[model samples]
Target: MPQFSRHSRRGRVMIAIGLSALLLGTSACTRLRTHQGYQVDKLLVDSVQPGIDNRASVEGTLGRPSFVSQFGEQDWYYVSRNMRALAFSNPKPVEQTVLRVRFDPAGNVAAVDRMGLEQVAHISPSGDKTPTLGRHRSLFDEIFGNIGAVGAAGMGGGSAGGPGGGPNGS
Candidate 1:
């Protein structure tokens, strides 16, 4: 059998130590998630003319929304998201905004509502959350903090899902 020399053995040990250090250091480092903030729909919401808010005109004004009509064919939604997660169990929605525009049958602007982050209510992911035992939630409380689940129940699990609970399990 071949035997390793002193220098060769030391070199291998050093390489192993270096690799171990790197792996350990990387693992120790925190994994942070960075997200972009709420950017308004400058194309449509900002430049829209109330009187000229017809379907074609609104489409031209806003280019295309984050979403559009599916069933009723009268509502448009512009959405934006933001998040920052450093040492949390889950990422929180730092900021979120949705611009909802409703049109009359003639396509004239009927109503315009701007919903911001404050308008939303944080819920549980189970989509089956019952009332908690108490309400003295800390800053890092697990409950009453999560932005809720996406396709698990309340938010509706369809492509045409609205803000809250979907059809199957949002």
Candidate 2:
């Protein structure tokens, strides 16, 4: 029969506990960095000039935009964000860059604008039920509200219904 001494078994248990605690301690303070969208190169971006650069040249220099304006003035946006998260929590935007390049009718660059985290909006949802403007009713009212709403003919004032039961009430 195989046997383990008391001291050996105690040492194994102590080692296991210590390893588990060490794993958890390291994971608890782990900081994760996530990069999203276009990576900006200062030198390349600075070279793009208004009136001097057209659609073709801009595309060649900076590649395709992250997104184009859907409505109003012709504009291109290159968005970038640096998100940081710890453990399993939601990532928060630590840094953001939104570069807007506007174009004139001739497809030449009109203006260049840069924005940062100051423009980022943080919103908290209002919860499961959307707040709609109307009269509020209880659960019971919603379930039984339609009971006997119409007359015997289904419609408030109808003779009978389909078949011969029409305008003549045959």
Candidate 3:
């Protein structure tokens, strides 16, 4: 029987504890995979046929959409993104897909479009102030800017309810 001495056993125990801590510490560097928004399946996305499928049918097949257009046109958008992150940094998109489904007047599918990360707008703000082509004005100028421009102090401007306000100065 190989019996370990007290010093040898303590050394082995310390080595084991060190290895365990090293394994745990390396977990911080592990790449984390995450998903956001819609989970797209190639088969399901390809199955949606335009001109034949309606909103209900598309919803039934692909589930609820991520967002609906609120402006001039009513369209459905399915946004899917795969993100990767290390321990404590902001997650960056590994893969992103934006699917736009347009509808006709009768609610039938007009078209189906799919796009990738090319649609992403990386807008780093230039500064605290947004750049504009207009002339710069101070707080006092802005507050009293329009006060004297519209009508002079005693000019007979035909206003709605004042004297000389009407077409006939009655």
For each candidate, give its TM-score against the true structure: 0.50, 0.79, 0.68
Residue range 63-110, candidate 1, lDDT tens digits: 567787797978988788877565545767777788887898888877
Q: Find the number of clashing residue pairs for candidate 2.
A: 0
lDDT (10s digit) by residue, model 3, range 44-127? 999999999999999999999999998744599999999999989999999999999999989999999999998789978877
Off by over 4 Å in 1: 1-39, 69-71, 87-89, 125-170
Best to worst by TM-score, what's the order?
2, 3, 1
Off by over 4 Å in 2: 1-6, 124-130, 151-170
lDDT of 1 at 158: 34
Give the runs in model 3 whose Cα sits over 4 Å from its true position: 1-4, 126-170
- Per residue, candidate 2 scores C-alpha lDDT tens digits across 79-132 of 999999998889999999998999999899999899999987778887888888
Q: Model 2's lDDT to the true fold?
A: 0.87
TM value for model 3: 0.68
Which has the better lDDT: candidate 2, or candidate 3? 3
Best-to-worst lDDT order = 3, 2, 1
* Alpha carbon lDDT at 91, candidate 3: 95
What C-alpha lDDT do the candidate models reach, one value each? 0.72, 0.87, 0.89
